[model samples]
Target: MEHVRDSFARQKAMTLIGASLASLEAGASEIRLPYRADLTQQKGFVHGGIIGMIADSACGYAAYSLMPASASLVTVEYKINILAPARGSLVARGKVLKSGRTLTVARAEVYADDGTHVASMQQTLMMLPDTPDTPE
Candidate 1:
């Protein structure tokens, strides 16, 4: 759990929420991201793409924390569903559905701070072997 705390604390984007999601571990995370002007659409709601990115990042990190230190993972596929328009602030909750040697499956839910479920996503990640370091 110390590694999870330290790792998220050092993460730039995830740290935007301060401690909201910083204490997240293997089970679930409640992440927050304020809606800045850059994150809004013409209708003054958070953009779909931004929501997708948040969901993807949450799931990826959740999977990464469960892997061995020498392994890494990348998204193989993702499916997102926009449930409602997102406004003001956003909160994404991520959970690991399954973790295996070569693959991980996760789900995330994006909600407006007002408690509206804005989107949901499921992501599949492909675990990769760590690259060996060579003497320079």
Candidate 2:
């Protein structure tokens, strides 16, 4: 947990966007972001790209939390579906569906603070071989 929190704290983009790590566990994590006009689309809803970014990061970190200390992860691909306008503070919850030696699969769902589902994401991440410099 210390490592996970430390790793998350180092992500500058999360700080820049006012995103925070809300929770963390062995195979799960959540991030929250407040709604800011600067982060919205022309229609005043949170942009889909921001939603995707948090989703990806949340999922990636979830996978990372379960990885061995020497391993590192990189997202190989992901797909996201925006289902509703994100008009309020948002929370993205990510969970590992499968952890493999070479590949990992995770899912994330973003929801408006009001309980509206905003987006869903599925990600495939590659687990790189361990290296001495790996942070965790």
Candidate 3:
């Protein structure tokens, strides 16, 4: 839990978006973001890129939470589908669909505060090999 929290604290984009971890568990995680005008597109709705960012991090963190203490994780691939206009506060929840030694697959869903599904994501993450000089 400490590692997960610390890792998230280091994300500059997350900090800029005012996102925070809503929950963290062995193979699941949730991120929350309050609506901010700066995050919106010309349509006055939250931008799709912001939706993807939170969804990507949510899935990445879910995989990271399950990785060994000495390991770090990186997103290798992810696909997101934007379903509806994102309004108000948002929450993205990620769950690991599969875990392997070198690869992990996860799914995530972004929802508006009132529980409207705004976007969905499927992600693949790779475990990074540590170099002798590097630390997790």
Pick the winner on lDDT between candidates 1 and 3.
3
Clashing pairs in 2: 69-136
> Model 1: which residue pairs collide?
none
Candidate 1 lDDT, tens digit per residue, 1-136? 4545454566666555332453367656666787687777899888898888788877877777776655556899999999999988888888899988788899999888889999999999987777311112
TM-score of each: 0.81, 0.94, 0.94
> Ten consecutive residues with minimal summed lDDT in candidate 2?
127-136
Assess each prediction's global lDDT (C-alpha) against the native: 0.75, 0.90, 0.91
By TM-score, who's the top model here? Answer: 3
Using TM-score as the measure, name the better of candidate 1 and candidate 3: 3
| Steric clash count of candidate 3 | 0
Q: Give lDDT tens digits, candidate 3, residues 7-125.
A: 88888889999999999999999999999999999989999999999999999889889876567888889999999999989999999999998999999999999989999999999
lDDT (Cα, tens digit) per residue for candidate 2, span 32-75: 99989999999999999899999999998899898776666789
Which segments of candidate 3 are over 4 A away from where they belong? Answer: 131-136
Decreasing lDDT order of the candidates: 3, 2, 1
Rank by TM-score (best first): 3, 2, 1
For each candidate, C-alpha RMSD in Å? 3.7, 1.9, 2.0
Residue 125 lDDT, candidate 3, scale 0-100: 93
